[model samples]
Target: MTSAQVEKGSEHTSEEGYERGLGSRQVQMIAIGGAIGVGLFLNAGANIAKAGPSLILMYAVAGVIIFFIMRALGELLLYRPVSGSFAEYSREFLGPFFGYFTGWTYWLLWVVTGMAELTAAAIYIHYWFPDVPQWASALGFLVVLFVANLISVKLFGEIEFWFSMIKVTALIGMIVIGLGVLTFGFSAAGDTAAVSNLWAFDGFFPKGIGSSLMTLQGVMFAYLAVELVGVTAGESENPEKTLPKAINTLPWRIGLFYVGALTVILCVVKWTEFAPGVSPFVKAFAMIGIPAGAGIVNFVVLTAALSSCNSGMYSTGRMLRTLADSGEAPKAFNKLSVTKTPALAITVSVLFMGIGVVLNYIVPEKAFGYVVSVATAAGIWTWLMILISHVRYRRAVEAGRLPASSFPAPGGSKGSYVAIVFLLFVTGLIAYDSESRVCLYVMAGWAVALGIGWAVLKARNPQIAERREPEFEKV
Candidate 1:
C-alpha cells in the first residue's frame, strides 16, 4: 500500500453511535481510579513481605514507565481518538490480524480482571458479614455494576467518579494520619512509628535485589487498568483537551497513591508487620489505634474493587462492539440500546464475568490469584501493542506517510522503545517466577486459540483478511 493509502486509514474513525457523555471531571477520576485498585490496597502487603522498603522503588519505577506508556497513547489519541483505542491503532499501523488479536485479547483481559475484582469485593464484604457466602457477594456486585454500565455512559462515569473519589479521599486521609503520628507521636503506635521502620527490620532490600525484582510482575499488575483512559476516547466530550490533561496527571497519581501511601504505611508499621493477603492500610490504621479503622479501610478497599470491576464492565462492552464493527465478532454486538449503550455487548460480557462467581463458589481460596496472573499477562500484551503501534506511527510521520500527533510523545519513539524493553523484561521476570509462570502458559493457550480463530475467519471470509483502506485527514 502507498503512503497516502496508509495515511488515509490512519485518520480517526467516527464514533460508532457512542454518546460523548463522559465529562472532564469524570474522566479525571476514572484515570485516578484506574491507577489505584485492589492491587495497592490488598496485594501491596504481600509484595512488601517480598521486597520490604524496596517495593516503594518498584512502584516508582513502574509508575514512570506507565507515564511513558500513557504519553505514547496520548499521542495516538490526538491522532485518532476512538473507543477502540489500541486495537484501532494496531489495525491501522500493524495490520488486520494484529487488530483482531488485540481486540479479543483486551476483551479477555477485562473479563478475567473483572473476575479478580469481584472475588476481592467478596472477600472485603466478608469482613463486615462473615456469614454471607462469597459467591453470593460476588454475584451481587456483578449484577450491580452490570446494571450501572447498561444505563448510559453518563451513569457509568458518575458512578466511577464517586467510587474513585472514595479511594482518593481515603488514601489522602491515611497519609495525613500517618504523617501526624510520625511528627507528633500522639497515637498508640506513634511511639513506635518511625521512618526507620522501613529499613530497621532487615535493612533496605531486605529480601535481596532478585526478590525485589520478582515483585515487578505484581507491581505491574497493580498498574494494570491505568490505560482505561485511552479506551474512553470515543465517549470523551473533548478528547484533545480532556485526554491529555488526564494523562498528564498520571505521575502525580502514582507518586501519591502508590509510592507516597506505601511510604507512610511502612513508616507507621514496619515491613515485618505486613504479610501476604492482608491490607497494609488496614494494618497501619489498626496500629494507630483509630476506632473502627480496619472497618473503614475495608470499606474503602471495597470501593476500589468495585471501581475497577465497574471499569471492566464499561471497557469490555465497548471493545466487543469495536470487534463487531470490524466483522471480527457477531453483528448483534454492534447494536446500541435506546440509551445509546451497547446493551447486548455488555450483557454478553457480564455473563462471562459471572463465571467469577462460579469460581468463587468452587475455589474461593484460589480464585483471585489464578485470575490476577492471567489478567496481568493479558494486560502486558495490550500495553505492548500500544507501544509497538506508536513506534510505527512515529516512523510513518518521519517518512511523510502521515501527519504528526498534536500531543507528540516526549522523547518520541525512543520513549516507546524504552517502555517496550521494560515490558519485555517484566515478561521475562514473570517467566522466572514459578507462581506467575502459569500466566504465561495460559497466554500461550490464548495465542493458539486466537490463531485458530484467525485462520478460520480468513477461510470463511477472504475480505475479512484484507485491510480496508479508509481516507485520512490531518488532525
Candidate 2:
C-alpha cells in the first residue's frame, strides 16, 4: 500500500504509520545512547594518541557543530515529525531525487555502520573469550540483537535504554574516580593522577594543532549517529517536549561524557601510554588497580557496540519503510507486522549486515577502521542534507507556506548555513587523508548510482516525481 493509505485524523500519519510507542523516558535514553557509542569506549584511544589532550578540545568544538545540526533537525521535526526523518524532509523541501537519495544513502550508512559495530563487538568479546573466533562472536551477537529488534520497537528502546544507562553509569564512575585521584593525591590511579597531565607531558597540544586538525575527520566520525534522536520524533510519544529537551541538553552530554571522561583519563595516564587499537578506558581502569580491569571494560565496550548495532537496525527499518510507503521501494517493505513494526525491512537490513561477519573473518583487526571511514564520510553527507533541507524549510515558513516551527533553530537559517560550512571543512579533512580517501571515491559512485536509480524510479512511477507536499498550518 502507498503511504497515502493512512486513515485521516489518526495519530498515524501517511509517512509514519507505525505505532507511537516510544515514551518520553525511552526517547531521552535513546538520545543519550545515540551519542555515546563504541566510538568513545573503543576508538577514542586512537583519537587521543593522534591528537593528544587536544582531542578533548576537538570533541567540544565538534559537539557544538553537532548541536547546531540537531537544532536544525529539531526545528524540522516540530514542523512535521516522521519516521523517515531527514529523507522525508529532503523530499518535501529539496526534491524527489534528494528525498530518494537521502533515504537509500542513510540506509547504506547504517548497514556499514552496523558492520563496524559488530566488528568492534567481536573484538571486545575477544577480551573475555580469547579462544572464541571473531566471526563466531560477530555472528552470535548479530543474531541476538536481531531477535531483540524484531520483537517490537518498544523492546528496541528498552534495550537501548539499559545499554545507554550502563555506558553513562560507567562514564560517571570514571569521572568520579578520576577526580578523587586528582584531588586526594591518592587512590587506585597512583600518584600520577594530577590535573597538570592536561598540559604536563608536552603541553596541551603535544602533537601540535596541525596533528589535531588532521584527526578531525575521525573525531567527527565519533559524533556520526548523534542526530538519531531527531529520527525518533515520529515514534516518540511526545516529541514536542522530548525532542527539544534532548537537543537542548546536548552541551552537558558532550561536556560530561566526552570532555569530562577524557579529562579524567588523560590526567591519570600520559597520552604516550595509550595504544592505537586499545581502549583507553581499559588502560585507565587497569592503572587505577581495578581488578579484572580489562574484563570489566570489555563488557562496557561490548554493550557500546551492541548499542550502535541496535540503533542501526531500528533506523534502517524505519528508513526502508519510509521509502516503500512513498512508492520508492518494493511494496512489500511497506507491510507492517502484528506489532505495527516494519519486520520485512528490518530483516533485509539484518541479512545485509551479515556481510560484516565474513569481513570479520577476513580481516578482523582492521575491519572496524575500514567500515568507520566510509560511515563517517556518508554521515557527513547525511548531516549536510539535513542542514540544507532545513534552510529551504525555513524559507517555506517565511513565505507563508508552513507554520513557523515551535522549536525553531536557535540562529534560524543562518545557524544552518554556518553548520554547513563546518561540515564541509570536515569533508575536506576526510579527502586530505590518504588512508581515508577511499570514502570520497565510494561516495561519488554511490551518488551516481542513486541518481540513475532515481531517474528509473521517476520513469516507472511518475506520481513519485509529482508528489505534492502535504499542507501544514500557514504562518
Candidate 3:
C-alpha cells in the first residue's frame, strides 16, 4: 500500500492507512441499515405472535438497554478509533485471551447470522420463484453480496445506503398507510386498523409476561447489528464527528423503525392473524387488499437478508484481519484487495456462510430455527465481552491508569452493570426455552472449540506473545 493509501481514500481526508472511503452519509446510513435487518423484517412476526401486541413494549424496553450498550461503545470509540474497535478494547482492558475470544465469537456470530438471514432470504425467493430450491436462493444471494463486498468499501457503502433507504421507506410507508386506514378508513382493511386491536383480542399481555420473556432470545437477536456502527469507525471519514452523529440517532431509529413500525403492524392486523413464518409487513398490506403487498414486502425482506449478509462479510473480514494482526488467525487472512477491501478474509467468510445453503438441503425444515438460536447465543457472547471490557476500562479511568474517554458512557459503569444483568436475564430465558436450549449446547461447543484452537495457535506461534500491534491501521 502507498503512503497515500494509508492517509486517505481521497485527497480531502487525513486518516493514515485506512482508505477512509466511507463518507459521513454512508456511515450514517450504514448505522441505520445495520439496526434494521432480517430480524425485524422476518423474525418479528414470530415474536409478535408469542407476545401479542405487547411486543411493542418489549421492543421499546430492549431498545433502551441497547441504547445504553451503544453509549458505552460510543465512548470507547472516541477513546481510540480503530477498525478492530471492541476487539482492541477488549484486548487492552480485559486480557489478550478475552479479546481473542471476542473477535472469534463475533466472527462466529455473523457467520451464523448470515446463514440465518440467507435462510430467510431463501423463503423470500420462494415467494417469487416457487419451483426454485431454497439452497439455490441462498447460494445466489451469497455470491452476489460476496462479489459486491469484493469491489470496494465505497461500493459496499453505496449498496448499504440504498438498502437502508429501502427499509426506512418501507417502514414509513407502512406507518402512514396504517394510520390512514385507522383514522380515515381509506383502505380496504375495513376498520381493522384501529389501535384498539392491540388490546381487543385478550388484553396487552395476552400470553403473559412468561411468554414475552421467552421470546427475549429472538428479540435480542433483532437488536444484533446495532453495534455495527463501531465496526465502521476505522474506515469512516471524519469519525470524530460522524461517529457520534450516527450513534446518537439510534434511539430515534429504534423508536421509529422497530417500536413504531410494529405498533402500526399490530394496529393494522390483529396479533392472532400473524403467523410465525409470515412477514407482518406483508400481512398488513394484504389485509388492506393491496394487490402487490406480498411482492413488495418480499423485495424489502430480500434486501434485508442481503444487507445482513453484506454486513456480515464486512465485519468478519475486518475481525479476521484483527485476529491475524494479533497473531490469533492465519496471516493471509489479513490481505487486502487493490480496492483496500479485505478480499481474502471476506471471501473466506462468505464461503463458510454458504454452509447455510448446504444445511438447507440437509435439513430444510428446521434450519432457520436451529441456526437462529445459535446466532442469538453468539450475539449475546459478543455483547457480554464488550460490556466486560468496558467495565474494566471504566475502572482504569477512575484509577487514573488511563485518560478519561472523550465521550464517557452515560451512567458510567452503572449502565454497563445494568446492561450486563439484563443480558444475563435474556440468556437465562433462552435456557428456559425448550426449543432454544440448543443455543446453550451450541455455546458450550463453541467455547470448547475456540479454547482448543487458541491452545493450538499458542503452541504454533509463541512469537505472537512478543508481537506488537502494527502502528498503521491493522484492521
Candidate 4:
C-alpha cells in the first residue's frame, strides 16, 4: 500500500483516531434533528396540562438554562475534540472513574432512548392500523434504523438532514399558519381563534408559578438531546470551524424553533382547551381548519423519532469505542469495519434496541412513558457531568496547565457551577413531579447498578489496574 493509503487505513480504527467524516451541514442538522425529537411532537400536550399558557414561558426558561449548558459543552469539545468528546473530557478533567461512569452511563442512556424512539414510531403507525401488533412496528423500526446506522456515517448524515428538514418545515408552517389565524383571521379549521385565546380562560399563568415550576421538568425532557451537536464535534470534518458555528447558533435555534412554536400555540389556543389526546402542533394547524392535522403531525413526529434514533446509534457507537480505548470495555469494540465504521459497536447497540419490541409486546401502553421518563433523567445526569467537567476544565486552563482555546466558556468556572446547580435542581424537580418521579428512582437504581458493575470490572481487568497509575498521578 502507498504511504497515504497506509495512514488512512490505520487512522480509521481505534477510539481517539477515527477519521473525521461528519461535515458542517451534518453537524448542524444532526443537532437540529436530535434536539427536536418526539417530545415536541407529542409531549407538548403534557406540558400544556402542567402550566397552561405559561408552558410557553417554561420552554423559554428551560431553553436559556440549556443554552448555557451547551455553551460549556462546546468550549470543552473544541479544546479536546475526540470521538468520545464529553466522556473523554470527563476523564481528563476529573478521573478515570468519572470518565468510565459517564461513558457507560451515557451508553445506557441512549440504549434506553433508542428503544423508546422505536416504540414511539410503532405507536404512531398504529394510528393507521389499530389492529397492527405494536411489536411489528417496533421491530420494523429496529430493522430500518439498524440498516441506516450500519451502512456509513455520511449516509446517516444525509438521512438526518432530510429528516430534520421535514420537521423544521412542519414547525415553521405551524408558526405561519398560527400567526395568520391570530392576525388575518385565516380559518383552516373554520374557527378564527384570536391571540386572545391565550388568556381567555384563567389568564396566562392560570396554574400559578408553582405549576409553571413543575412543568419545567417536561420542558427539560423536551430539550434533552440538544447536546448531540457537541457529540458530533469529534466526527465533524472541520471541528475547529464547524463545531463553533453549530454551537454559536444554538440559542436562537432553540428560541425560534421551540419557544417560538410554543408561543404561537399558546396564543392561538387556550391552555384550558389543550388536550393530551392530540399534539399542540396539530391542534394549531387544525385551528386553521387544516384537515389531516393529526396525520401531518404524525408524519413529522415519525421523522423526528428517526432523527433521534440516528443520533442515538452514532453516539453509543462512539462512546463504546471510547470505553474500549480507555480499557473500560472490551478491546473488540475499538475495532472498525472495512467501511471505516464502528460496525461491531453499531450492531451491538442496534441489537439492544430489540428489547423495545419485547417491552412493547409485554405492555404496550406503559412502555413509552417508562422509557422516556428514565431516558430523560439519564440524559440530565450526563449533562450534569459535562458541566462538572467544564468547571474542572476552566480551572486547569486558568492554572496554565492547559491551552487557552479559540472557544472559551463565558462566565468561567463559577458559571459552570451555576449550570451544574441548575441541572441538579431540575433533576430534583423531576423527582418531585408525580409524572416524572419514577425517573428519580430509576436514576438512583441505575447509578447503584453501575457502581456494582464498575467494581466487578475493575476486579477482573488487569489493564484497568495498570491504567489507574496514570490516573492517580494526574489527580
Candidate 5:
C-alpha cells in the first residue's frame, strides 16, 4: 500500500459531519485533562492507604502499561483517524460484532464514569455546602455540562481546556508547596515532612505486596479516559500531527501528575495520614496549615469531577453517533444539530448519566465506589480492544495485506501483547478483591445484554452482521 492509498483510506466516514473545531491546544489540554480526574483527586487517598508508598510503584507500572496501550492506539489513529476510533478498528480487524460491542461498551463506560464523577462532584460540593443535598448538586452539574455540550464542539473544547487548565495548574502548585515543606520546613508539617515519611511508618509496602497489587484496579480507573484523545480525531484540526504529539507526551504527564504529585504529597504527609474518601492533595494542604488550602483543593477537585463528566458527555455522544451510523443503534442518534454536533445523542447520554443523581439520592455513601468499579471494568474492555486491534493490524501489515501506520508503535505488536496481559492481570485482580468483584458481575450482565441487542440487530439487518474487509484490502 502506498501513502496515497493510506491517505485515501483515512478520509472521513460517517464522522465527516463533525466540525473540526478542536485545535492543537485544545487537544493537548484535553489529553492532559483526561489523565487527571476524580480518580486521582478523591480516590487516590484510598489507594495510598491500601498500598503505602508502594502505591507510587503501582502507578508507575500502570502508567507504562497505559503508555503502551496509547502507543498502540496512536499507531491506529494515524492509520485511520475517525471519531469512531477503536470501534472502527475493531470492526475492520476483529469483526462487526466486536466493533458493535466495543462501541456500546465505550459508550457505557463514559456514562457510568460520568455518574461516578457526578457523585464525586457532589461530595466536593459538600465541603462548601454541607447542608445541600448530594443529589441536588449532582443534578445541577449534569444540567450545566449537558447544556455546554449541546451548543457546539468548539464550546466543549473551550470548557474542557479551562477545566483541565485548572486541574493542571492546581496540581503543579500543590507539588511546589509540598516541596517547600520538605525542603525548608516552612509550614506546620515542615518538621515532620521528609522523604523518609514514605517508609517511616510501616515500610514502603506497609500492607504487603498482595494488598498493593489490589490497588491496580483503582489505579487503572484513574487512567480510564486517557484514550479520549483518540475519539477527538474527527474533530481535531490536524489529526496526524496533533494526535501523535498528544500521545507522545502521555508518559511525562503521567509521571508528573500521578507519580511526581503523589510522591511529593506522601513525602509531606505520610501515607498513613491519608484516608479513603478524601482527596490526598486536600489533606496534604490542611496538614501544611495553609489557610483555606483545603477549601481551595476541594474546589479544584470539584472542577476535576465536572471536567470528566463534561468529557463523558462529549465522547458518549460521538460513540453513540458512530454506532448509529453503523446501524447498531437507533437512527435518531445519527443526526447532527445545526451546530454540527450530535445533539440528540448527547441528550440521550446525559439522561442516562442522570442515573448518577438517583444513585446519589438512594446510595450516596456507595455511589462513588459502585460506579468507579463498573467504569474501570468497561474501560479495561475498551483498552483491550484497542490493543487486540493493533495486533491484528500489525499482522496484516506484515503479511503485505495493509500498509503500515506512519506512527508505528515501538516494538510493533509486542507492546500491545504486554499491555493486553497487564490488563488481564488487572482484571484478575478485580475478581480476586471481594469489593471490586461486583464490577465483574455487572460487566457479565452488561455483556449478556449487548449480546441480546446484537442478535436483534442482526436479525433486522443481515448486512450489519456481515464482516467487511478493510478499505485498503478492497483496493
Candidate 6:
C-alpha cells in the first residue's frame, strides 16, 4: 500500500482506540467540569466589583468567543482524533516546533493550574480551620488527588463526575433560591431585602465600558478549562460520535451555568454591594434568612476546588504522555499502567502541584495571583497555536492535499483567522491591564524557554533540522 493509504488507515486505528476509553456521559461532564471553576464560586464578586452589573455582559461576550473557538476545535478534532488532539494537529499541520511549543505550554498551564486549585483548596479549608496551616491543607489535598489519579481512567471519571456534581447542584440551588427571593419575596431572619438590587443601583454597565473590558480577564481564564474536553478525545470511547456530542453542549453549559448563575446573582443582589469576601449566592440566601447558605456553599466550593485539581492532574498527565509519544518529553511519561493510565506522568505532575502547599505557607498572599498569571499566559500560547494549526489544516484541504473531512470548521479557513484575531485582541488586553501584567512576563519567559528547547532538539536531530529548513518551491 502507498504511504497515503497507511496514513488513512492509521486514522481509523486511532478512532477505535479512543472509542474504548471515553463514553458519552464522561465526555459531557468533563466539558462541564472544565468550564466550572473557583472563578464562578469565589471570583464572581471580583468581577462584580470590576464591572458592576456589566459583568453579565462581559460573560455573555466571552461566552460567544469561547463557543466559536470550541466549534473550530470540534471540527479539527473530528478530522484527526488522536491522543494529543490539538497538539498532534499542531505538529502535523503546522510543524514540529509549533507542536512542541503548544504541547509543552499546555502542559505547563495545567501544572500551574493544579497549583492554583490546590492553593484555593487550602485557603477554603482555612474557613473551617482558622489555625490550620495553609501548607498543610494544600499538601493534604495534593496527596489525595494524586492517589485518585493512580487508578484507571474509568475510576477517575467517576470521581470527577461526583465531585463536579456537588458544585453543579450547589449552583443550581443558589439560582433557585435567588429567583424565589426575587419573584415571591422569601423572608430570611424575619427580614426582607428587595430583589430589585440588580437594577435598583445605577443600572447595568454602572462601572463603565472600561471596567467591563477589564473583567474579561477573569471570565477568559474561568472558561479556560472548558477545552479540557479536547484532551479527553484521545481517551474517549468514540471520538467521532462522542466528541461532537460534547462540543455541541458548550453553548448550553456556558449559558445555563455561567450566564444563568450570574444573572441570578445580579438580580437578587445589588452589583455595587457584591463583595468578593462573601459568596454572593450564600449572601443572597442569607438575606432571606436562609440558614446554612455559607456552610453549604463552603462545602460545595471545597469540592469544586478538589474537582479542578483532580482534572488538572489528569490533563497534565495526558499532555505529558502526548509529548512523550511525539518525542517532545521524556520516555517515562509515555509508560502506561495496567489501567492504561500514564502513571509516571501523573506522579510527576502531582509532585509539582504539591509545591502549592509550600507556597501557601511561605507566601499565602502572593500565591493566588502568581498561579493565575502563569496559567493565563500558557493559555494564550495554547490558543494561538491551535488557531494557527487549524489555518494550515484547512489550507491543505482546500488545496486538495488532504481528504475531505467528516467534519469541517464552519466558515472554513476564515473562521480560524477570526478566532485567532479575537484571541490576540484578548491577549493584548490582558497585557495592557496592570492586573494581568504578570501574565505577560510569565509568557515571555516561557517563550524563551521554548526557543532554547527547539534549538537543542535541532542540534541533536538532523532530520528535524532538515524539516525546519524552508523549501523555496513555489506554491
Task: Give per-model TM-scores.
Answer: 0.96, 0.95, 0.95, 0.92, 0.97, 0.91
lDDT of 2 by residue, 315-433 (tens): 99989998998888999999998887899999999999999999999988888888888898889889999999999989988898677877898878898898899989888888889
lDDT of each: 0.90, 0.84, 0.84, 0.76, 0.93, 0.75
- Kindly report which residue stretches of model 1 are placed more than 4 angstroms away from their true locations once superposed: 1-14, 470-475
Error of 1 at 256 (Å): 0.7
What's the candidate order when arranged by decreasing lDDT? 5, 1, 2, 3, 4, 6
Deviation (Å) of 71 in candidate 2: 0.5
Regions of candidate 3 where Cα sits further than 4 Å from its true position = 1-16, 463-475
Off by over 4 Å in 2: 1-15, 473-475
**Per-residue lDDT over 1-475 for candidate 3, one digit per residue giving the tens place of the 0 to 100 score:** 2333433543443342457789999899989988888888888989988999888988898898898888889888877777888888878777777888889989998999999989999988888788999998898889999999999889999999999899889878878888778878876885666888999999999999889878878888999998888998778876777888998999999999999999888887889999888788877787888779768878998898888888999999989888887889898987777788778889889889989999988998788998899988988887887788789879978998666766788889888889899999998888888889988998898899989988898799776544244233354
Clashes of 5: 0
Write model 6 residue lDDT over 90-183, tens digit each, in one string: 7777778888888888888888888887877776787779798888888888888788888778888888888877877788887787777777
3 or 6: which has the higher lDDT? Answer: 3
Kindly list the per-residue Cα lDDT of model 1 for residues 81-165, writing each as its tens digit: 7889999898888899999999999999999999999999999998889899999999999998898999899999999999999
Span of 10 residues, lowest total lDDT, candidate 5: 6-15
Distance (Å) between predicted and true CA of 295, model 4?
2.3
| Superposed Cα deviation of residue 206, candidate 1 (Å) | 0.7
Task: Return the lDDT, model 6, position 191.
Answer: 30
| Candidate closer to the true structure by TM-score (higher is better), 2 or 5 | 5
- Tell me, by lDDT, which candidate is best: 5
Checking candidate 6 for backbone clashes, the offending pairs are 18-236, 19-237, 19-238, 22-236, 22-237, 188-288, 188-289, 189-289
What's the lDDT of the predicted structure labeled candidate 2?
0.84
